[model samples]
Target: MRIVEGIGIAVLVLLAALAVLFLRRLVIARQGGTIELGVRLSTMVPGRGWSAGLARFAGDELRWYRIFSFWPGPRRVLTRRGLAVERRRTPDAAELLVLPPDWVIVRCINRQAPVEIAMAERALTGFLSWVEAAPPGESTPETRPYRYKTG
Candidate 1:
């Protein structure tokens, strides 16, 4: 009986810790200019797939935090330079479980390496604009978000 009681207490402590971590993420995400953009780690393997997470915009970089991680730091930092969006695709039905509904997955180059990020269409436009926007004294070609043809 003592062993079982100890195990129950341990489980409750772990649950409380997890709840605290989740609440911390929510507070950080609620900060100004912080957007709840869903992201997924890209896999090059033909059979292996992706892992989803949430990203927060910090300054000029998008800091990707794993959804299940308790760590406070980002797993990956996506900067603006050398960030080329290769393509965008709508998520299929099965993917909906991993990604938000109707969100588009954007295949992009993160400093020469390929990475896939998923977010809402409007948020993607904002992301693209934020990434392409030039800094002071730097010349950048004007960019516009892509629009798909609909009938």
Candidate 2:
């Protein structure tokens, strides 16, 4: 009887935690210019470092928060001043299975660190537009038009 009660309580706690995560995702998505994004910090293993997250444009920074995280702050912040898009590509077979059908992969450099982002076509368009519209003289020459490539 005690084991049964323990299991029931554990299930309830799990449900409650899931509800909280869902609400957090909802609140983040309600913000302006927020989009579903997948960011991978490593490039050592191709098509292996993706993590689903929400990214929002705040001022001149694009802040990323993990989808399941409880923290209210961004996990990573990429500033417009030091971010550059190196190239864009279609996700390969392995990535396509894991990512959404319409999501594209983009390689970028932020503060001298490489970051890969996977997002839908519409979100990628918005991101490029935002980067292009940066404040005068804050843009880097590296922010040139993206060269398309296959994954």
Candidate 3:
């Protein structure tokens, strides 16, 4: 019957779309500098705006792509210039449900705009190192010259 054929075609289309998404994720994960991270665009409510994504550190840009997205490009690209880390904290009860157990939250200011990133400890270390390793003349908060105490 026509109804049966329609249902069958719909199922096939759904499966094909799923396959494509899986392949895309595989390819993206295979790229170097790619790491699984959660990005919160809005910090109005803690633990409410987190979206799981793949973040790639490319040169001076951090490109983020949603894990389930079909698009081949990054959804958000954060630049290293004028980026500074404000603080780091552990997630609350609600956030733990959405984020991994070992992940930590980091607040940052990018070009004076607030951005929150959630990632595991190792990834956090790498991120901090990257931000601090900016090229000369590109200053992040942690990259400033240290002042020595002369007693």
Expressed as tens digits, the lDDT of each residue in 12-115 for candidate 3 is: 99999999989988888888899899998666785688999999999999999998889999989888777777788888898998998899888777764678
In Å, residue 31's CA in model 3 sits off its true spot by: 2.4
Clash totals for all candidate models: 0, 0, 0
**In what order do the candidates fall by TM-score, top score first?**
2, 3, 1
TM-score of each: 0.76, 0.89, 0.86
Task: Output candidate 2 Cα RMSD.
Answer: 2.3
Model 3: worst 10 consecutive residues (lDDT sum):
142-151
| TM-score, predicted candidate 3 vs. hidden true structure | 0.86
Model 1 / residue 136 / CA error / Å:
5.4
**Model 2 bad stretches (over 4 Å):** 140-151
The 10 consecutive residues of candidate 2 with the worst lDDT sum are 142-151
**Please, what is the whole-model Cα lDDT of each candidate in the order they appear?**
0.69, 0.83, 0.82
lDDT of 3 at 77: 88
- Candidate 3 off by > 4 Å: 140-151
**Candidate 3: what lDDT?**
0.82
Best by the TM-score measure: 2
